[model samples]
Target chain A: MAKVKHHNIPLDQIIKPENIVFKRTKLFTDNVLSYCPGCGHGVAHRLILEVLEEMGIADKTIGIAPVGCSVLAYEFMDIDMQEAAHGRAPALATGIKRTNPDKFVFAYQGDGDLAAIGTAETIHTANRGENITVIFINNGIYGMTGGQMAPTTIYGMKTSTTPYGRDPKQMGHPLKITEIVAQLPGTCYVTRQAVHTPALVRKAKKAIRKAFEYQKQNKGLSFVEIVSNCNSGWKMTPVQAVKWLEENMLPYYPLGDLKDIGLD
Target chain B: MIVGAIVVDTERCKGCELCTQACPFGIISMSEDVNSKGYHYAYLADPYACTGCENCALVCPDTVITVYRMKVEEPSKAKN
Candidate 1:
């Protein structure tokens, strides 16, 4: 049904300049996001950029884009961004951070790019404690590749590669990559979060801001894993997929801090 | 008096409805008509009910919604 015109009052008259509470930040370009409708990637991207903008480091920050759905993240993020080969964002971020020590360097990668193809690079970056941030978006499957099973895909989840569902005996157990990195001494802060709701989104932003703050202090590696939803890949509507994630994904990949060395 | 309002960029919205669900006051709802992109956009169904909590803007994946809060004015002493 068509929305009724508001009380015959002009919008400008109703919404004044001083009454503005929130507006889009300039840190993001005008380009529309390429993510699917209701995809968590958009929220994750916004949170990261918002954190950078709030910290006043948008001009001095460099983002490394992975080879997955967000490979073109550089286009949307109005900051210096470099495209890395498949699963090589962490490695690229390490080189960038080491040379430009003053810049805030971060690698944005998906579960397939981080936990699968680039496992070695991901591990070593955290092991060496590279003074950088890693933003991992785990949607459980390879979203850009037609919904194939990913290393982080939970058990019994159906994917294009596993039509009958993921069999742990044949596919091996789902990888807890965030937990794996938290065990390493090099990681200064590591947390898992989501953005399905407002409260969760706020907490996720806090974690991201903390990650950047740690980066400013020259703290070791900081990793933030965001468990997200892939509606198109999972063959569900946006709403259904999010509900499924809450019911199925959260239990296997619980959200919380795994490691925090604290800011000195 | 109304304390809050929101502006939705109709063309940019994907009609995901997350904002509708996220609005604690249930003021936002999907439009019957579609935008230029053929997607139904969200609008404030009950504008006066908005509390400026920003919950809808925070959950909107497209980032098309902007929230505004009104400033409460004190009574003028000159009137006395």
Candidate 2:
């Protein structure tokens, strides 16, 4: 049941690299992910790192991780990483990119980080047409601060803050930051994807890759929004969280590219 | 003929059942016993039925599953 299970198979057959079907990407360190079980941050981290490795930009790429479950992203991703103040990953990325124009810079931020406290920075960076990429994870609720309502929380979604459910009259409406960012003149590509299922993971990875490719070509502001499941924060089992997301979240934050202006 | 298999890292597995749902062949299931992490880790219930599609690995948040596959040409009827 262990590595010894291959005892009957020929040594050469089992040891060959070509016969290897799947293995952990080397871009990720041996460090175990700190994200909660069934948390989508792990998948999002892996997909983005895989793309950076595949594109051979791992050595030169720089990452700005916002405060949240992803704050320790520097621990897992083997590349150089910098932690930014809450909701200011975009501003830090702007400075880093300006100084090191040759490096591929990307900022990874959560819904609360990007759409709320960092809203001004997020908008201004994209509006100014910074040659950088931003990865947004919209899980509807604040995952790091004990499941509170976030800027992207659904209209009727329940959270620590919204115990009786989010009231549209008082809370206004769920922020569609991806759509807002897409309308910015500097944004060259904008897409919203998910990672709850295997098929969806592939699509999300492709979108991240496209954003990186645009960055490599000096495209202005490629933003990718990933709709992820927060089973822990949502107070549901892993299976139930995914099912709920497919049922409730999809209708509100649908997938697919919101805009693409090509290389300009 | 394709031979497929997966080795589970029981210690690191959080047993979230993501791999169970990702298995297209339905050969993966949760183990009744708990691991060091107090989670029921996933196991390959029917190894022979595995298509080596790598779906489980892709959706695995823990990265605790590794898939291996080997393809062999079918022997001719005369040899059979």
Instruction: Give a tens-digit lDDT track for model 2, residues A1-264.
Output: 112121234434543567667777899998989988888998899899889978999999999999887889999999999999999999999999999999999999999999999999999999988999999999999888899999999988999999989999998799999999999999999999999999999999999999998898887999999998899889999889999999999899999999987654
lDDT of 1 by residue, B24-66 (tens): 7777999999999899999999875566679989988879998
DockQ of each: 0.44, 0.45
Which segments of model 2 are wrong by more than 4 Å?
Answer: A1-17, B75-79
Stretches of model 1 off by over 4 angstroms after superposition? A1-14, B73-80
Interface RMSD of each: 5.0, 6.3
Best DockQ among the predictions, by candidate number:
2
In candidate 1, which residue pairs get closer than 3 Å at backbone N, Cα or C atoms, i.e. clash? A1-B32
For candidate 2 chain A, the 10 contiguous residues with the lowest summed lDDT are A1-10
